[model samples]
Target chain A: MLRSPRAIPYLLLLPSIVVIAAVVLVPVLVSLWSSFTPYNLTRPATLFTFVGWRNYQRLFANADFWWAFGRTLVFVTVALNLELVFGLALALLVNRVTTGRKTIRTIMMFPMMFSPILVGFQFKYVFNDSVGILNNALFSLGLITRPIPWLVNGALANFSILAAEIWMSTSIFAILLLSGLLALPQDPIEAAKVDGCNPVQVFRHITLPFLMPFIYIAMTIRSLDVARAYDMVRIMTNGGPAGRTELLWTLIARVGYQNSQMGMANAMGYVSILTSIAFTFYFYRKLSLSRRYMGGAE
Target chain B: MAEVHLSKVVKRYGALEIVHGIDLDIAHNEFVVLVGPSGCGKSTTLRMIAGLEEISGGTISIGDRVVNSLPPRARNISMVFQNYALYPHMTVRENLGFGLKIARQSPAVIEQRVNEAADILGLSPLMDRLPANLSGGQRQRVAMGRAIVRNPDVFLFDEPLSNLDAKLRGQMRVEIKKLHQRVKTTVVYVTHDQVEAMTLADRIVIMRDGHIEQVGTPIDLFERPVNTFVAGFIGSPPMNQLEAMIGSRPAGPVAVLADGTELPLPPEFAGRVTADQAVIVGFRPENLYPAGHGIPAAGQTLDMDRTVSLSEPLGTETMLFLDFGGREVQAKMLNPRLVAPGERMPFKLDLGHLHVFDRASGKSLRA
Candidate 1:
């Protein structure tokens, strides 16, 4: 019996399908099933037990978990907005550099080249109160007589983490938005200038609107990056100082591995997934709206 | 009051100068076309007048004020770009009114001006549509509407119709002429197409290598071109140019052709040529035709009994190609007839309509 042409196509796809099922589908489905159980990573036999809604109930009652979730939301929102502003400014300035443009573009990507872990360690030393460079410079400049606790105080610690996060990722937005700026057609910009628009008005009406879709894309990517703010925060703060810098991932990591309450950690993880989904959906909607204005698909 | 004047305007890029110093004066309500081949700086001249390009030297004045240092908006001129340049994010109505809005006009006045322009260009229905939604021809109309809405001192067009299909270009050409008539604004149009310049311009400025070759009315350029470049560039199926030495004939002075065909020079070129002097003689295809068929073969005839190499029938007339002066010279047959390739044919070159250019400098010898 000879194999048909239809069977050959399916035969060619068999390897990819099997790999996807083993690598992606199985792990996702197993994790989803484990979220409904009171399974402990240390006690393998507990995976057989089913305790519906118990972990979720404990997570709901735990005010600390709720605070971490809310704080992460605020963190992502504030950090992303600030990144957008700085990135747009950087891109605008870089776009105007007629000479050595390629060199400037390469220089803009220098911050993005550093690992987030290294960045965290770097900022941790800079924010150290006793002998850090910042406090010493301030003391020498007569700006501050006392050594300020940059990483100890609640507001100051959060600001320090945000500053590190922004410094680490703002280049991503600048690079993406720079590509968008370069791709923008020159005709409309010239047309706007001839239409009596001053430079500010031209930017507000023509350049910014053209860059909206790109902005939303950068926002979506940065939101996801800030939401998973683990390695940097863990190295720098470890969610200490009265849980002042505690975020979803930091809290979940402690409960899952350190405290060994995997069931409750998985429950909190499921709830935190909602925030990422909301941001992605909102950015997608905004992106499509801007694209539609550009005469692409609605 | 909106006359435009350019006095010794020059353009340079670093050490390499592009446009040489040239002067021109455009009257109010006049349509002047800057016509030239590519890289001739015709577009640069238009851009300088529009204030998009800085003039390296000299001055450009629109109406009364010198607009050398003024911005494009301050110069009070509107331009239609080659690509239409309609704002993609805005509706046609918004695109048309954008200029007025930036000028800080009242809402009612902006709306009225926009509507009037839209009405003139038949763009009322497409006003709500984006430029992406409009056809090429429709987009061009909206671009025109945008220019018209401003009611500026002058209108500049940088080959606006070059992007359209040939049929659409012909249609839009008439529309633009009618638009100028209705609006009565000074228009400085630039095009590489001589036909467009001939049909639409009150005066045509021929440019070459950034220098103004000649400036004249359409008929003036057609009838009295200053050089071989203009004679060849200004006409379709361009004038045939042949290098020849002036050979003396007892009857009169004759031009010894490249293929050794001796033809008497036109009477108008008597003093301009002497025996053994090298000159380039040109005659349009329309002036050469099958003998005894076109314009009665007046003055003198240089007869050629040659084989028809190819014939292109253009419905009303036929163009016959024959070997002359070691190259193919075209002759127009006004009355169309069936003539096959390799068929023997006799044609006559019309001496009365000859153009004689000096060989070394390509300048016309006709006074």
Candidate 2:
């Protein structure tokens, strides 16, 4: 029996509130609490044993954790920037297509349609040192005297994973940027031309500025997506040839699930979330600045 | 300033030709307006002249140079777009200085030109504001300022005032006229509003369905339109056209209306028509008005009584709508009067200012 209008609103919202508590809120609180304790999957009673700052102190002192964190930062930064550059180029080229535009746009999205696991397996096979398609092509073209250890070399393995990530996610940036291009008004471009700007000047001054907001929006989305990259990296290198291609997510998965160190893994996960937050904050500021420059609300 | 010339200029998109081969000449420092209803090829013609659209055939020359292949920048012309396409990211000052900057002009010259344009357009205070921060009229001024900074040989305006409210449009229209007067470069403006054409044009080119209907001074077009379309298009409330047969009276030639009413045609058209030939009689609302409430006709006038079906009182004058020749026609009354519907009023038809056109070809019967 609802006694007041305020209570009625709460009663209606109670189901979603209960569901959130059972799913998101409860799990997040449990993980946060367990990070303060030496909780392991093998010992059920250790979940309640409070270990204070032990997990966090060990996490901070761990060299492997610091290495994985630094690698992840570099991975996210390099991957997002390269994706933006390539995506912008792709969007600009696709925008120039006059005929069969719809068909081309659909085809452009084909890479994004594949599941991440499928993308991982596909790139894993392509980067295989002995029988890989890439090395075979290089050999047949007389470009290489021997098969390159694509997934074996530390630098090459990281580059391979970055390539797969860029291939699967660049279309997201292109589609978003292309929508911005389509919605761009023709008058400004024409005005720029009549204002004595050449094609390059028109693009540099008018088109680029118009696309900045869209570019920032795409960067913000892709940064968060790439930060949590695990399944693809897991299948491709499984952290490494001696942990060279190890990222934060892959390392955390191995430590938490395989090594049964859930408390240390949860601490790593919490630290890794800060990277996403930092990227998000940085991109959001850039987005708002660009929007304001375009005479939009801050 | 450079005179612009078009010789058989045409525009085609694939197999569909929108602007047929049409020729026009604009003397240096002249303000020419291309005016017509929507889809009349006026805008296409203006864009061709601006070098924004490629001519499908023929040559467009600015000054002594044939600029058919020249880009808009190379042609040395500036255009103000209908939407006032000021770059949203740039300040008014930057927008004004952009062309000069792109041209590799020194900072001093760019600043001088931009400041001069800003001063001319009264945009100094708004120089730092982006287009979105400015009001409609301010943005319009900035658009003009951008054009003005270039010191172009010709200025192209594509319905620049069409975006403003009526009150602001009137103000901008006056500003544009002043801008042309001060700048004194060749100007080609396009608009469908005939009032703008009549007010601002030194010479008006009236177009219809991809063809030039007429080209003349505003008064020349108002007083002597070469065809029925020009006659009806160039005036407000348009010239009323009533279909009739050319009948001969003992006095001279007469136009016999459908309702058996006969109005005397001007003596100039006496030899231009044959008796019983199908023709259309055209006269302005001012020419057919309340007997004493209008300008006295120098020639003969036919008087009649008709019931006013509706009245549109526009301050100094009122337009009365009533049946004439079995079709509704507009007649004007000057100096002030409130005539209600169903009230019978005495009207005069001025024979001195009458127009007769061939019904088949719609060409004026004037020599």
Candidate 3:
């Protein structure tokens, strides 16, 4: 009663603002400033001694850093694209299901319910070089006399991690796109059918156009999540086989924790954030374009 | 020649059959309307002809081709839906040409037909706008244009004007009539509104519980409905029907209403009922008016007195609601005179325009 109506809303919102500042804003600003310094975790007093641009300079000249960066770009692109293709197919297939649709949707989300680390461990055992199920099955089936090393080879190791990442995340895309499929007005599809379009034509012309905005939303969210692909790869390979399958997080963790160079790791973190920014920007643009195609305001 | 024909058509869903076996023949360029109440399977019959619903046990032919097993596209029919299902993602030009484009016509042909349809519907100004940008009537015209672009053997409309407001609906009705005249396609339209059925159809098919009770022209249905159902379903503010018994009179036969009031029956229907036979006597509201003030009463006349319960006066006529033998009946009085409540006003009955139905079967006794 003491406060004005306008001021009361601001007063009620103050707690959330304070909480978010403490949890998110402080850490982000501190890390960004630290990325410009020679701060080390072991010697916490070095947090204030700023050696501007030196850490970034050393990172740019480091070949292994660039390799990890390039490898992560490739990994995220291949994994996210495959997830999208499979997720769209799964959504289309599940949309056609009339009976037990709820049960099917719940089952589809089973892989996403597991922790990423658990999925990594599960796939790790399945891909063990000599004793895992994959090589054992290959040996018993007489397809190969020698044991196929799944995790030891560079390409196979990347493929295994990509598979694990896709398995853990594709269902989210399917669920989102399926909900979009459900919300679509059925009249246009019926019109298309009456307008001489076959099933394939209907899917391409009407159904896919309606599903584009949903697809882009899923892509933007998954790009950010897949860029933070640390837990699964850490449990799976730990950047092993002489760093042959090294990604951005593995190198950054090694430099920041194992070598006690937090400032340099934070520098690498800033650069890695650029790739996620690029993907989010690309996907958001595409989402808005599709929305405009549906007659939404630009 | 029949453009679309359904012989012994039926529609069943699992254990329940909605449409019984029925027959309909829509001749070339004939506009036929199926009018009924809800759940009367009028839309089902239309869908069966469009190949949108699977027919259970009969043949539907489009111009001599038995399209029983064919899809809607193969059957070559177009439908205008109730909601005007224009594609929200496409402009009007694209929406109109989509059917032809899918049928693999050349660019010039699709363009020419789309332009022609746009010209017919006067949709050139809105051709570049998406469906969402257009108003409801514009969207409806675009829908009609989409159907016109197809130019198929038959056009099926499933309550296409049910969504419009009354004024827009009236306007669309006139436009649709003109479109039918210009396009000259066989049309099988379905609506529950008797007014729309009467205004638009060359022949009206009145359905009740999935069965066609009668099929006739507007004048035919209005003047000679086959039964009580057809009589009630065909007119607006429907015909007033009173329970009565056939009685012998010294002059002629009479319908003795329940309250001991005797109204003379026409001599043409003298033998349609016997003495003491229970019957339903029906007459249009216009037939009962203030004595000597109606448009000649339109039939053989009998004088009576009834008290007005409520009066609704329009500019041209007053609709007088009165009790006839303890039954609520509406009567029209021309020249707009105020008749107060509880006033026993002299009225006339057009006995020549009366209907007598056997109460047991609800069937008309007239030959």
Candidate 4:
């Protein structure tokens, strides 16, 4: 009874822990347990029936699932790398400007501030084949004669979605890398110049290595966000035409919400979780290695 | 191996001129210390010489080459920053060799130079350690070693020891002196500590508000200060200045204190006295002694019934702060006893070493 005063602080945190477990952890575990049965949302009583990996067996045989899995990997990898390149270029350009720097930084964050859904609607109007501004400009300039099927074709729709995803999230990488650039110590740069290092040598040896950790941090964050590229892809193509742009999310949504196969959808969700985990682990390892390059383990 | 000459060098930051047009000539292998208070533009002057700062007006030359427009690399001068800005990502060995490597020097030559610098700094065991793993003193030594391996014509130090603790500062001061002696590089060092300026400098340039107040050897500035600022700045415990009036008499000159204590001045003050005017009396604490030690009449002495304020007994000598005639006076006593507070002690001041300064200009009348 005397220890109740000291224990009260921890006791107060129990409510928050319980809420989080009920809302987040319990649902994930329940879904994971249901993946072993033939549970359907329409037939709720079937959740207790044991099916023993029948959904996973069906998933292994389903060619559409395999196609969707490969497509998601390619979409994530391309979008992330492209965003990195564009983000690095933007950061470098903005870092060089001495005046109007604050205005430029604020403008750079404008794209990131808009909700991804709004971005999808905006790009959807812009890339629409019949009455879109892009095609109208092209036709008026004598660039094209016919209405191009931008969202209907397989490669073009995938590229259009990838382009929108890159544009929306590239600013996140720039802001992070720019802060890294600002925090770099000026002494090494000065020392290198006095040591007769040319501009390229100074950047390759000193500036780039110092920016590696920040780059990895940005990469980790963006990779997770890109792996779940759903909003724009969901609104524009909706895995349309013939499942040409069907990523994992669209396939999972179709299986669970449209077809009511809750067990198969849960199994797919668990498998997709490994992609985010692998990326996070990879970036974390790189961050630690870069910190070791700077000094002892940070 | 090079002589640096600055002719009317000026540094201005958008009309706020920090380093006024000042001329100086540093002969080959001469160590000059620029001593001043903070914001006195001493470090700015060194940076100008190192080509880190733009010369607002006038020419700076190294070995007869006007380097006013040259960059830091082309100027062939190295600098040690106050923070010891070693590259945190590189090992000690790589940090020392980075410069030579960037310059495209031969691999063997770069290796040999780095080895020599590493040996000079006694960093053989720590060559593999990054800067985050090293101590402050080790990092400072690496900074020096980095500068040394460049073998530039001149070296500049921007108050490099200000970041260290007092004991380490004293130790590094000796090491820097030894390094300078061995290398014989024409070095321009900047510091605000007068003791550092006194101990390390061949010539000390005292600055005030962007103007050169005085430039002379340490002893020259000590024995013959051009003004009250230099007089008060270049000594430990500081030279004591007491407000008084100079009363010229038929015999010689006498400094009359406000408390009506008249003291005869030095014998060489026949021609430098004006009529009745306000003046300041300056003397070192070490010059004052107890009155019973066969005091002379030609040298003036003051007898005061003062309560001891604070007594600092520093093994060989003791510092006593005594309240005298509404002002505080610090005296350095040779064999001081443990005098408690509120005890009246008979203190006397020696007048032979007394200095008189004009109240309006703060210029020493003796100089």
Scored by DockQ, the top model is 2
Better of 3 and 4 by lDDT: 3
Put down candidate 3 lDDT per residue, B197-291, tens digits, no spaces: 99999999999888889999999999888899999988877999999999999888899998888888887787778999999999999988888
Cα lDDT tens digits for candidate 1, A1-298: 2398768888889999999999999977776677778878899777678888888888889999988988999999899999999999999999999999899989889988888899999999999998888899999999998999998998899999999999988889999999999988877887887888778998998999999999999998889889989999998898877999999999999998998777778888888888799889999999998888687211
Comparing 2 with 3 on TM-score, the higher-scoring candidate is 2
Q: Candidate 1, residues B48-92: lDDT per residue as tens digits? A: 998889999999999989999998878889999998878888999
The superposed Cα distance between candidate 4 and the true structure at residue A102, in angstroms, equals: 4.2
Cα deviation of A284 in candidate 3 (Å)? 2.2
lDDT string, candidate 4, A1-298, tens digits: 6467988877888899899999999998899888988889999998898888888898889999999989998998898888888888899889999999999999999998888888888888888999878889899999999988888899989988988898888888889989988887887777676666667877888788889999999989887788777788888888886999999889999999999999999988888888789989999999988877565211
Point out where model 4 deviates above 4 Å. Answer: A1-18, A38-63, A96-103, A142-148, A292-298, B291-308, B323-326, B341-350
What fraction of the true interface does each of the listed models get right, in terms of native contacts kept?
A: 0.49, 0.67, 0.54, 0.48
Superposed Cα deviation of residue B114, candidate 1 (Å): 1.8
- TM-score of the first chain alone, every candidate: 0.94, 0.95, 0.91, 0.92
Candidate 2 chain B worst ten-residue window by lDDT: B331-340
3 against 4, candidate with superior DockQ = 3
Cα lDDT tens digits for candidate 2, B1-367: 5999999988999999998899999999999999999999999988988888888999999999999999998989999999898898888899899989999999999999999998998998988988879888999999999998988999999999998999999999999999888888999999999999999999999999999999999999999999999999989999999999999999999999999999888889989999999999999999988878999889899999999999999999999999999799999899968888999988898989999999999999998
Tell me the TM-score of chain B in each candidate: 0.97, 0.98, 0.97, 0.94
- Candidate 3: misplaced stretches above 4 Å? A1-17, A293-298
lDDT of each: 0.89, 0.92, 0.89, 0.85
Highest TM-score scorer? 2
User: Judged by DockQ cut-offs, is candidate 3 incorrect, acceptable, medium or high?
Assistant: medium
**Interface RMSD score of candidate 3:** 3.9
